[model samples]
Target: MTWNIAHTAFPAEHRRFRAVVGGVDPDAIYRAVHEAGGFRSWDEPSRDLLHLRSTAIEVYRVGDRWVLAVNGPSVEAVREVLRLLGLGADRDVQELKGA
Candidate 1:
C-alpha cells in the first residue's frame, strides 16, 4: 500500500527512497536502510565505533557518498508505525501489493 508518508515527510518533494529515511528517526535507521535495499559500508571514521558495537548496521561510502537502500518492507502496517513515529500518513487497499 502507498502510505501518504511522502507528504508528511517531504512536503516539498514527491515520494522517493531517500525522503522516507530522511524523515524517519535515526534509531535503527540502518536497519531501515538495509531493509530498503542496500546501504553504505562504514569506513575508518566508523571503524572504532564498530568495535564498540554502537551502530545498527554496517555502512560504506561511494565517491564521497554513502551507500543507501531504496527498498524497504511493504507499507503493510506502515500507517500505524509511521504515526507512532510522529509521521502523518495513511495506509489503504491501494497500498497493498497484488491486492
Candidate 2:
C-alpha cells in the first residue's frame, strides 16, 4: 500500500499532518505505533496518544484516511515523531505558514 503525505502545518505547535493511505490496514498502523512504545490510551475512544520526549502525537482515523496531530515545543520533536512513523521520506509535505 502506498502512503501519500499531504500538507504538514508548521509553527510545530499546530502539530498536524495529514496523509492519504490506502490498501494498508489501519490495524497494522495501530500495531506499529503500539509496538514502537510510549503510546497511551487517549480519552477519545478511537485515538492513541504517544509521548516522545517533549512532543505529543495523536493518531486517529478519519474516513478512509489517517491524521497525525503532533504538539511540541520544537519542530525537531515533531519531525522526530514523523520519522518514527516512517513518514520522514514524504517529500510532498507542504509547510503551511501560521498553522
Candidate 3:
C-alpha cells in the first residue's frame, strides 16, 4: 500500500513504528524512502515482520514529513498499518493519493 507519511520530524518511539506489507522489493523501497531525508532503518525491531521488522526503516516523525512507497497493489492496506502502529484518528494521516 502507498503511504504519504508526513510529520514535523523523524519518528523516535519504536512501538509507534509503521512499515510496508507489500510484495515489492523493500530493499529498494527502503533506499528510496530516505533519499530526500527525514528517516532511517532500524537494525533491530521489537519483533519480526516477514524478516523486515529488523530491516524496516523509519520514514518520518510526528514533527516532520516522510512517505511510504508501496511497491504494488497494497493500496487498501494502509488502514491496517495505522492500526498495527497504534496510530489513531487523533494523529493526522494524510493520504496523498486516491486508492
Superposed on all Cα atoms, the candidates' RMSDs to the truth, in angstroms, are 15.5, 13.9, 16.9
Poorest lDDT segment (10 consecutive residues) of candidate 2: 16-25
Model 1 lDDT per residue over 28-76, tens place:
4444444544344554642211111111232334455443222223343
Best-fitting candidate, measured by lDDT?
A: 2
Worst 10 residues of 3 by lDDT: 46-55
Encode model 3's per-residue lDDT on 1-99: one tens digit a residue: 999988677445322223333233334444444442324434333221222222233332222323332222232344433333333323333333433
Task: Please identify which of the two predictions, 2 or 3, would achieve the higher lDDT against the true structure.
Answer: 2
User: Best TM-score goes to which candidate?
Assistant: 2
| Cα lDDT, all candidates | 0.33, 0.56, 0.34
lDDT of 2 by residue, 1-99 (tens): 999999977663554333333333445545656666756556365566666556566667677665666555555656665666666635233343464
TM-score of each: 0.24, 0.50, 0.24
**Ordering by TM-score:** 2, 3, 1
Off by over 4 Å in 1: 1-76, 91-99
